[model samples]
Target chain A: MSARATTRPGGRSARVQQSVHQAVRDLEAEVGRDALTVPLIAARAGVTPSTVYRRWGDLRELLSDVAVERLRPDTAPADHGGLRADLEAWAAQFAEEMSSTAGRTYIRDALLGDPGQGNAVRCSDYAVEQLKAIGVRAAGRGEAVPDVETLLDVLVAPLMYRILFRPSDLSTVYTDHLVAAALGRGPATPQTKS
Target chain B: MSARATTRPGGRSARVQQSVHQAVRDLEAEVGRDALTVPLIAARAGVTPSTVYRRWGDLRELLSDVAVERLRPDTAPADHGGLRADLEAWAAQFAEEMSSTAGRTYIRDALLGDPGQGNAVRCSDYAVEQLKAIGVRAAGRGEAVPDVETLLDVLVAPLMYRILFRPSDLSTVYTDHLVAAALGRGPATPQTKS
Candidate 1:
């Protein structure tokens, strides 16, 4: 038996992995996390159950992999020429992603699972990376970048809290306040309706 | 049959309700929400399955009732003679509650369950009430209270986000920063390590 499988791009193994990952996402979106099963995923992926077991070990492991992939920002943060603009754009994008069904399901599963699973850590790291990207852009434009941890505490954390706990639409106004608070602009004043 | 059930406190109906609610909490703490079952709850409460069905109709309704009860802060917000002090004390106490096993379990269940279930709203309302109490006290002392919505958006929301996402203990410094941010004091500077 050969010690290594095919190394070429778009090979059988690569195709199998892609299909399986897509299957997990589709099934999760359709039926939710609890209803997901190894056999169902394998069937959906057009692979054998043994293949799934050999590759990922179990449902939880497979789900964790999918989570890590999905939790990552879909695109690079846009450089908006200023710290406040960059931060607000990033936050607005993040809040939009989190409000989606797919995003919410992935986050909820990771959080509801065991903390030792490292899913939360992956999610946190993803946020940190996005923040770092924004910070780098700000520094390039000769701006004093705010502390990442402080930004997380003030802006990102509150946005996420509203997303998960309050179940409201992520308003641009809300994201703007978060940026202002992080920059020491003060608490976001509420807009009164005319 | 009479039009009304007994209105006396600690009557049979009251006893059954208390026992069932306690059973839900105990089971959730031990086995978690996913493992919870109506029959299991009935057995733990020492009530019949029929009684469980007749009283609450289903597991979700029972859980919602329990959630409403548990999410309410047990004690009133302390009147610490100042807005900042009162806010910090309240945040500290809330953070402590959220750090415990029971508190985390309750929050996780509420978040993971259906959003339309009203558990999250009850929890948010609890925080709002606590903030209102502090605001009233601040006004009594001739101190200008920050906008209630602003306080919720900054202080309460971020504290909750930290509780759910990050596994770290809530520090006094973090709570102080939230209060400061709400009061337009500035970004809370990190405390120096001893």
Candidate 2:
């Protein structure tokens, strides 16, 4: 459940969706992702298998739906005084979260069975929206910031490419380098975590 | 069959692998990806289902193997007179080839069920090798070109991100922009095909 769930607070449809989503999360933790089925999820949610089928069509789509919900950020990115510091902190945290095992799983799940790329767009939009907020904050403070697309190309894409295809090569040093490069700064200095 | 197949020219294992890979290609073209099964692939390859199971473990692994083979470039990137021209041409072609429907399918297949991430690494190595070749050519010509890692981050990553997640938003203009950015050039001027 996301902001949508809050809008339709008392709706039966929203309740069923919440219950089904909860069941999926519980079953994933209890058994694992591979063992999940519509009937099992429906049973756990106190709903009929037909209801699950009607709502989600199949296991893959259901998984995609759940993944999208999980990937939605709970809050706007934290403001860190200047645009450079704000972007650096955001990019560092983003790399850390997205490169994790569970994070990669969610990303893959979000893309699987996404024929229309709707789920993929939804996921990308989350990043886009967050970046836009950062840009707005920088502009308000009279600090120039790179456009959202530039940030995506220079920062987000590299992180995702590493997550999907070269997880072993990804490092905090690399993330810091990308943030610096995106801002048209000179060569990177390796960041030490506090 | 790749160069590996040539090394063991007439070996029984190589023969089996070639036949199986060929069968997968033909079947994929004929009946499509979703209808594929281990038994069907084995039958098509003139091998028993048990043989396929014993060799490949499952359909997903078999698909990954075929995808890796197909993703391997047939030849080294064609060199242009200058490093900038060579990189721009290569990036444009790479963007075109990878963003197609079949190409996207191959990428997905290569990644699916890849527990060891061996397939993913292999696919990445293909790009790495190509970029290295381009770099070598530039160095030979005494043209100071950007490093392969920079190309991967500023060029390949964006193409892949769009192909996997935001395909509709990707354009030739964007591809050209990435190449320019990677080369440390100013704003891109759109290229027209001859």
**Which lDDT tens digits does candidate 2 get at residues A20-139?**
988998899999988999999999999999998898888888888888888888788899988888888888788777777777878888887576678988888899998999999999
Model 1 regions lying over 4 Å from their true place? A1-19, A28-35, A45-65, A192-194, B1-17, B26-36, B46-68, B191-194
TM-score of 1: 0.81
Chain A TM-scores of all predicted models: 0.78, 0.89
Off by over 4 Å in 2: A1-8, A187-194, B1-8, B168-170, B187-194
In candidate 1, the residue pairs with backbone N, CA or C atoms under 3 Å apart (3 or more residues apart, or in different chains) clash, namely none
| Displacement of the residue B35 alpha carbon in candidate 1, Å | 6.8
Candidate 1 C-alpha lDDT tens digits along B1-194: 00112233778899898888888878977997779899999999999999998987678667766766776676679888788899888887887777676676667656655446367777787788888988988899899998777777777776676566665546776677668777877566464311
- Share of native interface contacts recovered by each model: 0.55, 0.65
Worst 10 residues of 1 chain B by lDDT: B1-10
In model 2, how large is the Cα lDDT of residue A114?
Answer: 70
RMSD of each: 6.6, 3.8
DockQ winner:
2
